[model samples]
Target chain A: MSTSRSSASSKSGARQSKVTVNSQWKAYLQHHRVTAKDSLIRLLKSPGSSIMTWLVLGIALSLPMTLFVSLENVKQLSRVWDQSSQISVYLKKGVVPRLAQGLSDEIQALPQVTSAYYISPELALKEFSAATGLSDVVEGLESNPLPGVISVVPSLASQDAKAMEKLQDQLMHFVQVESVQLDLLWVKRLYQFMELGQRMVWALALLLGLAVLLIIGNTIRLSIENRRDEILVVKLVGGTDAFVRRPFLYTGIWFGLGGGLIAWFLLSLGLYWLSGPVEQLIGLYGSEFVLSGLGVKDSLLLICDGVVLGWLGAWLAVSRHLARINP
Target chain B: MAHVRFDNVSKSYPGGHHALSGVNFEINQGEIAFLTGHSGAGKSTLLKLIMLMEKATQGQVLVDGVNLSRLGNSQIPYHRRRVGVVFQNHQLLFDRSVFENVALPLRISGYSSRDLERRVRAALDKVGLLKKEKQSPIELSGGEQQRIGIARAVVNKPSLILADEPTGNLDPTLSAEIMRLFEQFNDVGVSVLIASHDLPLIDRLDHRVIGLKDGRLLNERPAGGL
Candidate 1:
């Protein structure tokens, strides 16, 4: 009778096990959902401290990000300046306006030149006076001292130092050209400076990323200590390491999400605050350049980085402390 | 086969304090036994070995015919699931409701929500705390809290139950009630091994007793032989 009872139950158990295979996946997802929601609620419950942690993480995340966006704007500014770096060919005193115009047309036809424009002596004098506020002093001269000038913009392919120098040497061979000047030294220096700045930004980002890890790790460690009893009880009641680790991991992820959003907010706010002043300053430079903040892709990246760092920090903290709790 | 077997098991701490030595015993399937000893007599250590909370310093521990020493780290949770444990302090999470507390093991085992709810209610109903399922364990009385712990232990329907000083903080009547609860589970073919120093209670219950003294096996008393 016992054998028959056991066999019948075993048959039913086999059927139940088959159904459990599908339900097991559902249960796993449900647990994750529950843990994630519970962790988020825990964070919401302690809004004061949660915000404090997020703020710390935000500040850490924003420091390098602020530098990065500023560097991006500086790069944009350099590109504008780079396009303006042209060969200024000053003609001899005897050269007439029509001859200067012809020379400009000839230079424009060169394969290396993108465009060339002749600046009459009068326009150059006016620009010089307007820039220096010395119009009256320039009007006192009997003859216009400024020569007819031809400004030559090299093609995109010839923007490098060697190519610009070569174009300068080529323009110097013109008979009407008195001197062909290309002040590319400062542009080259600026390029080097920007490169160095980029390296510095990367280094700063590395350091700050480490700071973020340490901050999150320390926070998680303290939380683990606070929930030590819960952990002990869970372990005592057949909770797997992964099961015990889930809620804390979710906490870390929530922290990361909040911190990322905050960092993005801080960055946008900083750019917005600086934008008006920056536009006024660029207006003084006589260029209509707009200051750009962290764009959507970069904002998403920042958040993802925050999440990854938070997870890593929590994992590190939990692993270290979990090994010590035997119960 | 025995549900729990200790073959000359011995355990020592790092400082050379032996918690158990040459302890050999068995609690057969569906048999209820009491582990009786004074404080520091390795009763807890013996339970720990069965739960894989601590490894024996020497010899073998076989539970439900599986050699525990051979089980890998990842398999420990699966092993633990087959054995339920009730702690002396009745380790309930005060942060949650009694229902959630009892649902913990089932949750850890990844039970479906419907099954979890049903089984949790069943366990709580068995413990006679079904009405207080929504209340926090912190608000419950000592006896109720202990019963909640028992509910959590039995919620997963484990083959064996081990209680460490389960009735230590209870009055005689409450303690007897708890022991009778264990008896009810044993009647349903679940093996039970409870560690306690309450000799009078153990004497009255009249179950088999495995006695330990200074980390060594002292005596084994059959039911009604005291």
Candidate 2:
């Protein structure tokens, strides 16, 4: 009976301590909420300054993010083009249609060639005449001068750019072919340019990110000076540096977050604004490709980046200035 | 009990302006003491040293047995939790209500909401400004603002309270009322040390008084007995 009574009392004490801890946490959160509310209210009160700061940050942040998204879009386009890279070989005149077909079948049997197509000289001449708007000129000719071309398309499943080039060169040695043309130069250069552009975008983004930090730091310094008296009061009232810095940190976060949202909006706006013109241009070229905006994953990353930058800027400002303003 | 001890403490600014020179004094527990001095006599510096706002260039400052000079950065907040301070300018947060100002210390010390509300109300009631709890400090008179400062200082039930010219901006009557409030807190076992140069006001309070001249303690007297 005595043991049971002691155990019961101990359990009650434990329960009491747990309740106390829970209550303490609730109170802590309540205080933080009050502080956060006051901070937001203060920011709202000075809407002009807040807006100005946020705009500066947003513009700064948006430049890199927009560039990054554009670069990503470019990357996607390049990826599609890179995968579509294939060599098209056209044969000379007087190659028999049946011989061209046999050559195509042989090329298709090769491991390097994914597929090959045999176009008879008659069909080739007809297609050329239609494409160039020179059907009357071809009609007056005595014979179809166009070649019985065997087009070779290589597979990208293997990693062999040099091997593919060599294979294209070796196809020129065929007895039935007079000349071979491989149109891979422009595609290779285009891929290289896209990669270079991505690197440049990253470098520029990093440099501008540092500039944003400095801007935020200086702004926070001015804010600290403006609110020197308030800070002194807080310090005198036994507020820790962390407690004193909470609001400024929130301000910085808000700046970053707001700036990020603005940047996202601006990027989307730019993409939306450009889409119609780009689609019309593509239609003129008889292409069905549509320009795409930032994808879901990328948009999320941009928002996270904005918030982090704002947080980092605020942290930098507070650490540098709070040390100088003692109670 | 809140007592402050300065042992061979000295403070010199970076530009070689010596604010305090080997200052040594002991304020006993529950004693209401006046740190009286002329302008730039290091009265402010002394209070700052005790509050651990400024580190001593030499020697140590101990408050309630904690050596502030040796305290770590993280531990500074814990040290401050034991002391309540009021500034010369009242330095009340103008953005907050009087009740919220009083609740600042309690909030920092992590007091529960129910306890914070109760204690803040009690502090405002003690300062005779309970009705003005919802009023902003900026909306109040100078004396009322100083009282709010006082309420903030004492709300946490700290063992020691330091006021640096808390009434410098107030009239004589208001100054006396502020001193009375400090005395009332002192009577209840909270040590009070106020830095002021108002001779007449200092003469009226029956408490210990320490005088500083040129960063050195010149004399000390027992309130009206001086």
Candidate 3:
């Protein structure tokens, strides 16, 4: 009977300890809830200040994000252009059409050559006349000024700039070949310009990002100053720095989140506004390419960036100013 | 043991204005004392030292047996949890309701939700402002706001309570009522230190009065009855 009684007491003690642990957890959660509620209320109290912070952050975040998206678009276009780098080798003026066709076949036989096109001097002249709308002028000439040409479209694996240049040098060494032209200068210039633009965009984004941080930091500093008396009272009433800082941190997060949402909205509006004109211009070029705005992944990244910036700005403000406001 | 003590404590501002000079005093557990002086006499500075809001430029402040000067930044919060404080202007958050304002300490100390609700209601009841729990501090009168401050201070059941001119903004009748509240808390074994310039109120309270003059201890007088 004594053994049973002891065992029963042990069980009851275990239950009591379990209850105590549960109560402690409940208390901790309650404390966090109270802090969160207070923070939200504090942010909602001053709508003017909150809106001002959100707008400043939104504008700052949008500039970098928009530039990044444009850079990505340019990169995509360049990748497509880079893949189309091919070389055209023209034969000598006196070369016969049959000889040019034989030369084209011989070039195709080379391991590096993907495909070759044989165009006779007459056909080349005809194509030129049709394209340039100067058939009479060309017809009156004693002989066709154009030469027979072999257009070589390299394999996708050998389409790099260096590989194409090397192949052009090889074609120039051909006895019957007059000249080899790749005509990729415009594409190369476009690629280089895009690289420069990417760097400029990043530099501008960084400067503007710093400006955003300062704007947020200053706003939070002002907020702390305005609530100087309240902070003093809180500290006097046994409130810790963490307790005093919780609301301000939440305010910063809200500003960041709101700014992110606003930036995303503005970007979508800009894209929508520009879509009509962009489509019209594309139609004029007889192409079906459409201007793409931020995609799902990019949009999510933009929002996260905004929130991070907001949080960082708030952290700077709170850490610096909260120390100065003693009870 | 001394519930609160200041040993040779001095505070000098950046421009070299000494707020307190070589002040030494101790308040035993459950004692009630009034810290009295004119404006700029360092009464507030003394209270601040106990709260760990400001470090003494020289010497030590021990509260509940912990030397505050030796405490690290993170340890200050735990030390503050053991004390309650009321301010002159009440400094109640205007955005919060009276109940939420009074519940600040309890929330900081991390009470259970049910316990916080019960303790907050009890504190408001004790301050005779339970009916005003739903009202905002901005809507309450100065006296009511002061009561709310008192409620907030005592809600955590701290061992020591400090008041810096808590009744400075209230009229005579309200000030007397507030003093009575402090006295009641002392009767329940909480050490109380109040800084005030109201001689008549200190005289009526019959507690020990520590007087300060020009940042120095002038006199220590025990109330006539006590």
Candidate 4:
């Protein structure tokens, strides 16, 4: 009975302390909320300085984002051309129609070659005469001079430059083939242009990311100087470094968030402004395509990037500057 | 048991300047004492040791039977919360009202909103500035600002109060009133230590006094004027 009573009292004591600690955490969170709000209000009290910071950050963030969007649009346009890769195989002179048809069958049998069509010399000459309207000149000739042709389409997977070049070389070595023309140089050029654009965008993003860090770091340093006296008083009153750092960090977050919103607004406005002209151009070409702006995912990513960079800059400043202050 | 005990305590600054050496004294619980000395006589350093502001270089400082030397950086704030401190400059934030200034310590100590209001009001009442809660400290007189600093120090119900020249800027009449307030707290079982060079004023009060000169302790008085 004595042990039971002691254990019961000890349990109650433990519970009481637990309750106190929980309340302490709650109170800390409450203070954090207040500090966040107060810091934002402090920023708002000086609107001119704060707006300049946001505008600088917004311009930095929007440049790379605009490049990325344009790169996406170009890629969308090139996708249609990727699907229509064709190769023209011209027959050697003195090749018979049956030999040409047989060679076309052999070309189509290759795994990388999707399909091949045979064009006899008779039909080729007749079509040429009709197209050129030169039947009198053709009738004056004694023998037909047109070569048999095989039109080949490569598989989607083998539509790259290296693969097409290799296939063309192999066809040139064929006994019945005289020349092979793979018109994929335009596709190759477009791909190179897209690659260069992507690399440039990444470089700009990195350079501008550093710019953002410097901006936030400088702002926080000034803020620390402005509140030097207040910081000393807080420290003298038993406030820990973490406690004193809470408000400045919140200020940095607000700045980053505001910059992100500005960038998003500017991006959407630019896209809206361009959409009308782009739609008319698309209609002039009788295209059914629509201009797609940044989706929900990209916008969220942009904002998250701003927030992280802002946080990192503020953390760097606080850790460096706050420790130097002594009460 | 003594509320504060210094056992051969010594302090030296970074440049080998000896601030205090071989200082020894003890103030029992519920006692009021004055630390008097000339400028740069280690009076401030001695009080700072008790508050754990400056670590002792040679010996131990025991406050409420806890060795101050054992405290780490994380523990310093908690240690300070138990000891109230009033400054001569009354470093109150001008942006806040008088009530907010006094309520700061309590808020930092994690008091709930409901308890915070009552405790802040009670502290203001004790300082006899209950009517000026909403007024800014800038509008108040010098003595009132000093009292607001005192209220902020004591709002957490600390068992020890350390005042470093708390009334240095106030007149003799106001200084006496501040001393009476410290005495009231001492009567209620709080140890109060005041460091000041105001010999004429401190000598008029009936309390134990410790004197220091050039980093050495002179002697300790039991219960009398210096």
Candidate 5:
């Protein structure tokens, strides 16, 4: 009986503390909601300065985001061209068309080669005449000077310079082949250039990210100075450091969120403005490539970046300055 | 038990300026006392020690059986909540209304909305400014502003109230009225300490007096025997 009574009372005590914890949690959330709303309202009250800060943050956020997205698109375009790394095998002038077709069949069966198509001397002459508009001059020759060619396209996995060189050496050993041609230097150089561009973009992003941090930090510091009296009074009245910091942290979030949205809008506007001209330029090159803007995933990431930077900047400013403003 | 206790407490500034040295006093729970000293005589520093606003260079200060020196930074806010404070200059935020000013302490303490509203109104009513709740404190007279400050201090219903020259600018009549207000709170079992230089006014109160001069304790007088 005694053991049961003690257990019952201890359970009751546990429940009592649980109720208090629940209420305290509720109160904590309530304060956060109030502080967040109050900070947003304060920002809205001062429209001119708030808008300027948002604009400045937006421009800063957009510079790197713009470069990143543009590089992504350019990388996609180069990837398409890179996959087309092909080798043209020219047969001797006197080689028979049947032997050339046999050679093309054998090349197509190679592991690295994707597809091989044989172009007869007759078809080659016709294509050259059509391309250069030199049919009568080419027909004026005693016989067709153009050689039979086999164009070998490598698989996507084997598009690198070393793999192309290996394939070229194999093709040169073909009995009917005269010369093997592969433009290897430009392909290697383009790969290196694209990698450098990507690294440069990332470096720029880091520098600009630091700039954003300093901007937000300075802005919050000025705000802390402006409200020096309020902070002192709050501290005097028993406000905790966390309580005093809630509103400023919320303010930083607002700036970050607003700035992120503006950057997204600017990127979309810029992409839209450039898309038409970009399409026309690509069309002139007889290729159809569309310029893409920030997708949903990237846009969300940009906004999250702004918010994180804003939070970190505010935290830095608050921790450094609030300590000095003792009651 | 004493609501506030200082045992050989000493405080010194960075440049070796001792704000308080070898100060000792105890205000038992439910007692009202006045701390009298000239300007720069360590009255403020003694009160600051109680509030944990300034740490003592040596010795201990206790409030409600808890050593203040042992309290960490995070515990200071809870300690201040238990001890209400009224400043000399009526540290009221001019941008807010009278109601909001009194509600500041309760809000800081995270009172529910219903409790906050009812308690704020009660505090304002106690100070006789219930009807002026919506008006900005800047629009009120000096005495009214000070009353608002007092209302704010007591809004959270702290066990102890510390006033630093709360009536420094008020005339004799207003000052006596403020003393009566503190007495009323004392009558309800709240320990009160007022730091002031108004000797005549302090004499009229007939409360216990703890005197200090040049960072040293002078003497103590029992109530009704000053």
Candidate 6:
């Protein structure tokens, strides 16, 4: 009976301590909410200069972001160029049109050729004359100088430079063929330039990311200076560094979110302004191409970049300056 | 029992400017004492040692029998929670209201909203400022601000109250009233230590007075020891 009684009393004591610990955690969470709201409100109360900060951050973030979007568009254009890669196989001078037609069928049956069409010399001459607005000049010629040609669209896998070159060599070896020309090398060069553009975008994004961090750091440094006396008072009254730091960190978050929102606005405006004209131009080419804006993934990544930079800047500022102010 | 003991503690800055040298004193539980000295006589240093704001260069400083030197950085806040401090400047956060100023310590100690309100109200009532809860610190007179600082200090019901020249900016009537407030706290088992240079006023009270001169203790009297 005595042991049971003592155990009951100890349990009550343990329960009391547990209640206090729970309250401690709940109160800390409460303070976190209050400070977060307080900081956001504080920023809102002083929006003139902070709006300027957000504007500057937005412009800096949107520049590299716009460049990246443009690079992606160029990449997409190169992909369209990749689709039209074809090889032209010209017949020898004395080769008959029937022989050229048979050769075209044979080339179409090859693994690398998706499709091939035979064009007689008369038809080729007519197409050239019509394309150049020189029908009278072409009709006055004594004989058709164009060769019978087999136009072969390569399979998707054979569109690359090395594969197309090999395919051209194989076609040139045909008995009736005089020459083979692949229309893909220019697209390959364009793709290389697109890759270089992507690299430049990444480099510019990195430099601008540093710029965002410096802006946040300088802003936070000013915040710390403005609250110097308040910090000293807090230090005197038993406030922990974390307790003091919570609000400033919240301020940094507000700045980041505000900047992110502004950047999103700017990017959307630019895309909206360009999408109509771009679609009209694409329509004029008789092709169906749709302009895409910032998708979900890219938008989230941009906001994440802003938040991470904001946090890094605030952490740097608080650690450097808070220690100098003693009670 | 001795609640605070400074065992020959000495403190010096990096430039070898000695703030406190070989000081020893103690304040027992349920006692009130005055620490009087000139401007540079180490009163603030002694208080800083209790708050663990600065470490002693040599010897030991103890609060409620715990060696302060052994108190790690993580434990410093909890240590401070148990010691009330009222500064001479009455460092009330002017950005907040009087109620918020008094509620700071309770908020730090993790009091629930109900408990925080009750304790803050009780503290303000102790200083007869419960009606002025909604006013700003700037809206109040100097004496009122000082009382607000005291309310903040005692709101947590700390075992020890350390006042650093708390009445230095107050008039004579206001100073005595502040002393009475400290006396009331001491009457209820809380130990109070006030640092002041008002020698004439301190002599009028029966509380013990510890005197420091040139970073050294001249007298170390206990409560009721005259």
Predicted complex 6: DockQ = 0.25
* lDDT (tens digit, per residue) of candidate 1 on B1-226: 6668999999999999999999998877767889988999999999999999999889999986888999988888888887888989998899999999999998888889888899899999998999999999999999999999999999888878899999999999999999999988877667789999999999998888999999999999986575
lDDT of 2 by residue, B1-226 (tens): 2268889989999999999998888876656789999999999999888878789999888886778877988778767767788877777787778888888777777778777788899889999999999989899998988888888887877767899998898888888898889877766666678999898988876567899988888888875575
List where candidate 5 sits over 4 angstroms from the true fold: A1-19, A89-113, A118-150, A156-181
Candidate 3 per-residue lDDT, tens place, B94-211, comes to 8679998987776666666677788899889999999999999999889888889889888877767899998897889999999999988776667789999998888887878999
RMSD, candidate 1, Å: 4.7
> What proportion of true contacts does candidate 3 retain?
0.30
TM-score of 2: 0.81
| Cα lDDT for residue A76, candidate 5 | 72
* Residue pairs clashing, model 3: none
Q: Is the docking of candidate 3 incorrect, acceptable, medium or high quality?
A: incorrect
lDDT of 3 by residue, A1-327 (tens): 112222333232232212246676777676667666766677778788777777777888888787887777666655555556668798888987788888899889977788999988898899999999999999899988888889898876666556777778888988999899887677667767877998999898899889878887888888889889888777766677777887777667777788888889888888889889977976785655567898999888878887788778889999999998875
Name the weakest run of 10 consecutive residues (lDDT summed) in model 4 chain A. A10-19
- For each candidate, the alpha-carbon lDDT, in order, equals 0.88, 0.79, 0.81, 0.84, 0.86, 0.84
Q: Candidate 2, B127: how far from true, in Å?
A: 0.6
Q: Candidate 1 regions off by >4 Å?
A: A1-19, A88-113, A116-151, A157-181, B224-226
lDDT of 4 at B157: 79
Cα distance off (Å), candidate 5, residue A299? 1.5
How do the candidates rank by lDDT, highest first? 1, 5, 4, 6, 3, 2
- lDDT digits (tens) for residues A19-95 of candidate 5: 24555567678889988998899999999999999999999999999989988888777667876677889999889
| Share of native interface contacts recovered by each model | 0.37, 0.32, 0.30, 0.20, 0.25, 0.28
- The residue pairs found clashing in candidate 6 are none
- Predicted model with the maximum DockQ: 1
lDDT of 5 by residue, B175-212 (tens): 88888888777666667899999999989878889999
TM-score of chain A of each: 0.75, 0.71, 0.73, 0.80, 0.77, 0.74
Q: Model 6 residue A243 lDDT? A: 88
Score every model by TM-score.
0.86, 0.81, 0.80, 0.86, 0.87, 0.85
